[model samples]
Target: MSVEVRAVPGESLSFPGRITRVAPPRTHWAPVYRRRVVVADVVAVVGSTLFAYALRFGNAHAHPVQALLLLGLVPVAWLAALFVFRAYERRFMGLGNEEYDRVLQASVFTLALVGTTSWAFQLEIARGYVIIALPLGMFTILLLRYAMRKWLHGQRDRGLHMQSLLVVGHRQGVLAMVRQISRASYHGMRVVGVCLPPAADGRLGVEERALAALGVPVLGGLDEAADVSVSAGVDAVAVLPTPEVDGAFLRRLGWALEETHADLFVAPAVTEVVGPRVAIRPVCGLPLLHLERPELTGFRRLVKGTFDRVASGVGVLVLAPVLVGIALAIKADSRGPVFFRQERVGLEGRTFGMLKFRSMVVDAEARLRDLAASSEGNAVLFKMKDDPRVTRVGRVLRRLSLDELPQLFNVLLGHMSLVGPRPPLAREVAVYGDDARRKLLVKPGLTGLWQINGRSDLDWDESVRLDLRYVENWSFGFDFMILWKTLGAVVRSRGAY
Candidate 1:
């Protein structure tokens, strides 16, 4: 028997009877078998508890009843905690650290609950059993989850067991959503078709055309999306929300999807707000998304600043002998001073004398005007790959980025950070357009996104984009990542001249 389901834009439809038949060739136990993962977790917990019991009580010969009881309760407690923690939800599986975090939390909660219950009920549970079993169960659960995650990731990499999605929204919004999903296939969304909402402009953007060329079907307007989703056999419908998705229309769409068992997903318009930074606060009757502003002050700022100062201070102290040797090398190779200071724009557009160990001739600035016409930099900036102004010692220093080591002092003086936007010269800031001024929103750094990402090799637009992206998405974790990458970039010296 065949059943028909009716769906709408932003809604899902499923028929009462099997809407689609599964062929023998299509059936597999790898990707879509979420039940298998839960079963594996339960078995692993039970097995580990049993082993722990044996290890703690010899062969369980003296306390067979007690060992069996504890092993039996382990699975029960774990399953209960997993359900309470929503660990089995397919939506959260194989994505982000949240899934693993829940597994740990559930294990901890289960162990605590079992311990507390034994004490309160006076069950005379052996301390050896509790001590050994708890850690063993927790470690086993984490290890099993990690192994499952690796297996799932392999499946995703091979394009198996992914959810097929029907994108529905205005042409631009749908196209944007399609591009993002296609680029991040590890997220497990396969865009099967796009349902463009009726609008004045019938033409799709360049992005949409590119997606269409890649064989993603472009279904007609929203009115026809229901039929398309059913025909395409999509598992979910993601509504790429335009400004028009008000509460009333969203509610109605939810009601329409009830007949179809397909899941519904809503993509918000806000960008740069990752899961950790956004909180949904239901004020009165409206769902208000509260985005926590990037904290640049208070305890976090204090900690970051303290870390920067102490780290930079120690770096300078450890590298003092190297610094002295470099200074002597510079003097031996050229007549220039040991260090150079240039006027640069810093935080909030404040002017500062940015210091670096000298890597140019004494008359380099004077010669710059003569060589200005042949400048190879981004036009506004001045750079020459084989400039004659570089001294013998300067060449080595520049290549290894030893020239900027003195900026550790700048970080200690609060004039810079261990990580931030690249400090712009005064001349560069003068030529910056209004949009470019946003780079000064935070303190400039000695090395940053531009430095690690090919440094002088990047075009003007690309450099500015990276800098602004850093400002918008600044986090302590991101800073550490940049720092780690910087070490590798320095070793390669890809863009360091």
Candidate 2:
């Protein structure tokens, strides 16, 4: 058996006559991470329960024996419940909603079990103690998990604890997949090398040369990918969409991967569509991927609309003082009205007056024609970094996103949503293709994917892509996530003009 040196992105390694197997280094990190999470969970559970007990009983001895026993049993049962629910699974340790969802399910299960047992046995259990302890414990656990996740992501960003992937596909597909994976390194997969489909001239293609330029080595042609994967000791093999890699080829690759510890992943043709909208069902013994249409109407939409109105109404009421202060400031700083209402296309191409605190001069619109030549925005939207039309207070309001606070009223009036596509100007919508027009299916948002993502820094295609992605995969949970992230974006003030 011949030993092989470790693989690098730009440099090719030789395996000689045969390759000696070595354990994947990245796999070891997962178990270490899971152990830390387990310890953190244990500490959170015990501390929260003890704190709850102390708070509820106040060192008094009403039923000390039962309370002590209950305290001891709860932590053990909680850990058991988490394990039973597979909350400690490696796949969910570092990212995604599955880990948090599992922990929540386990906590709920533990609470129910405790309540049922106490009732069945006629055991004396304090309602206050149970209520405080369960929720406190769950919240503490989630907090610790979130901290650990951030640390893990930081480590991965620095090129640690990441799975090395050997991507096999057409050059274009491979490049697209690699770029996406690289951009989201928190997902913990790094494309170290690629195996492109063989060219007709048996020479490197332009895309292959581009990959090499980016320090991603081209291992071999498609037929040699399995052998190369094993020789390269890759943690996973990602096969992108390509006609050359058929079902039979995938089966053979899967079998080949079994010899080593590598996992095989096949990318579907539909990349933009994700989450619950796409499902795989077995039909006639073959897996068929079913794509569902976007749900713009029905009970879910009603719930979404209801949530928007309630949330925006509450927000407006709570921020009334701040809103008044902003209005006063805008009035003092500008010669125009306190609020700026611009006509923007909303749901189904309907026009509505979107509100914002006036952040520009009274004749800002009249001056737009002169600045068109120096516009720094995308093809559709006209934006200038240092436009002479902006007022002194406008910069601060725009940076902190205070100018758009008045849009909450639009949300309450059913003209906008708390989270959806950005409101487009009539001119912007005029150039829309069929795909881009899908953004009109839902109401415009006060802040959405485009805002949290680069905001004004994004080009036309990317902004439209993010909006389309949001439209394709809209849900209450998704909206909540975008709203949560929007707070951070506002604080950071990145890409704000």
Candidate 3:
């Protein structure tokens, strides 16, 4: 069946194609999700208060009802601070790092207020209670929000909580966006229909089957975009790269969609330029996007370096026995050295000896040329799922990535960061593209975006794209997330040979 939306400006109207079987409309879901988060915050705050009270007083019931009442006041005051900071707002609930940032903001603001109040009232607040309760509440709140996000992602994957989108742009742009949005189901955008710009009509060469395969039907031209949007129950009108999606058109489009309570989302042709690097400021009614130069040096780098050193040290210490076991297995299964050291290209094209537990035959490198013609790997890197050179021990080591445990030393030695772009083979760097050379800006990582996304399985272009994306948008939080995701990726053993 069909629902209604608006048209883009100026192309002939045709009977609009429609999307079907969309689960009921979820336009008000953000608020519903926000409410869940609010409830979670309350649970977290209350539990933390009780825990703090117990931790401090040991269930002594020293003042009976008075102590319980005093402890209860903290949660009420904390919730008020969260409300004042707008941490419970719907806009910050589902995407990016903003939710965590808001939670932290609210928590710190509450803590500050608590401290100030205690000082003003000349009441001696127990430091243990303040420290324990604030951290526990914050941790519980973040855990609950993470659960909510996971639940939301699950819903979106099954076509719930998705924003219906009408794409208005060139034929290529519409198709590309449809496919892109389809691939990233967690993005929660469903491109239900498309409206092409008139100038590109002759170049249409549009394949109905290809677009329909993604459940996105093209509905005439840009003139009918608004009408198609309304007909499709579109929640957002995506104006892709096209001259027709200009200032006057967008201004009017915004007005029309506002009446429908639908949003106008514009996408420029450029990709991967996101996060803290981009900002939009209006000048003379034109919204100008400001791009910041990536900072590779200074305090953040020091923070990253310190984190790498400390984390790698702990990892090595904890994994010491596992490392020994792998080395022993390799020694028993094959006639080669337990450790493998290969020259790899690092930051600024410097060469470093990258270490690993040997996960291939001693003559694996010598045998590479013989297998070159039969290589099943992506371009540049050579990999084979059933490579004959891999010993039995090597297979198990590679499967669980136990072979790379020695690289913790690389991270500890200042040769690498715990998370950065993958260290390139010297030969890979030799033929690097101008754009790919940006991967050399930081220390190579023991693991990174490329590693977690798909180790040996990603195509050369995708691998390079991920590396470049990481180089451009390096942040400590991003690194931590990648590291967290790495565990799942390793367990699944996907893309690993």
Candidate 4:
């Protein structure tokens, strides 16, 4: 089930698992998925245009013939805009915000095209028709694309339409890559085999036996990676950064993979740095990775702050009735104050009083010491599924995450953001390491990656990782996506005790 892989020099790498059988390569997925997207886009655009035509002109309108002509032109132009924006490209058909981002761009472009063309040609395009059709078509396209993405993910979860991946690197690097790929099936990468550097002894060692346990096949040595990928029928080859994988080796590997259908990917040693921050630059035929510093201040921060305050202000007003009802329920359920305020660490390690609905008994703080030992939470976080201090109403509120609603006021008061890292308790901050403290670079959030990912179910390491990822990759679009998903998480109530 396994073969000895030569250990590269410098530090010894080990994989404490066994190798498994590699699946037959599946390369037909991208083309089929791209076709589905194209059909969906056309349907969405055409359907929205027809609906708008009916709503605006009706059957008896005198401009019915003209409207029909305009309708045909709009869909054609819309699809062309989408194509021009690279929305239909294979790279953008499946995952990431890039797909949605491109769709939005295409929508804006289509709007511009319609307006400019009508203005230049002096065509009698109805203002009402233009307004209705553009917005409806944009919304429909986004909706259908989202549905298609969900379907693709569901198929991937069932091990269908996955790219068979061959990992080439030292044992430890290979193991980390494989483990990460396994956790996020939505990425559509299925690790089939690995190629490691030649071991010094040329004999199966403890690491080899360990890798044998995990069942990912050890195909061959590093030098044979390209051949192994081709022979094993892999869709892609991921080469982890190591001393053994120099620029020359990578160049050769790239040239080698050009003959096969498999794509070559070189993973940088730096982890958790992606999106806009990392960019590849080629200087004199050498590829250089440039990482931009996180924008924690200046114009972006000002914009985010303004948005947080405005959104929270409107949110509080909109939810006034619900908030009042919750306050009354809490007063009737327990002998405590309607609101709970706890000192939490915020931006730059400053202390702020976070607001929440009172979800526990009057003496809950006093009883913490007694239940600390039985907490089900990970290190630094104290949580209990069935604590005696929780009032009956408190449990219901917590389950629905209604208890955190008052934090909107915190957000309005500039104490937190609508989306960012979770506000850590002062006690938790006391024990935070350098990496964990990096989360303090930005304002804490009412809901964040931690909230939607698993909430209380995630361990300290996982919670910190998610928080760090959010802090490092904060964007308006990312924040909006998190806010949207938070609604689903709240409804599911999976880890919300």
Best by lDDT: 2
lDDT of 3 by residue, 1-497 (tens): 34332234553224342444332354777878888888899999999988887798784663544464447667888888788777877656787678888889889988888788778887667777788999999999999988889899889989788887778887766776686688568777787677765443443254444675665656657766665666556788888867766677777777677667577888865567778888888989988898888879999899889989999999989988888877778888889899999999998999999998888889999999999998777899998999999999888888988888899999999999989888999889989999999999999998898888778877788789889989888887889899988997889898778
lDDT by residue for model 1 (55-139), tens: 7777436356565568776678787898799887776677766777788889889878877887788776777877877777777
- Among the numbered candidates, top TM-score falls to 2
Candidate 4, residues 16-111, lDDT tens digits: the string is 233333557456888888888898888888888888877877865636646665778888988998999999887677788889889899989988
Worst lDDT 10-window in candidate 3: 4-13
lDDT at 357 for candidate 3? 85
Residue 27, candidate 1: C-alpha displacement in angstroms: 8.5
Give the whole-model CA lDDT for all candidates, comma-separated.
0.74, 0.86, 0.79, 0.84
Once all C-alphas are superposed, what RMSD does model 4 give against the true structure? Answer: 4.2
Model 3: CA > 4 A from native:
1-24, 27-32, 58-69, 171-179, 198-215, 268-270, 281-287, 366-376
Instruction: Sum up the clashes in candidate 1.
Output: 2
TM-score of each: 0.64, 0.88, 0.85, 0.86
Which order, best to worst by lDDT?
Answer: 2, 4, 3, 1
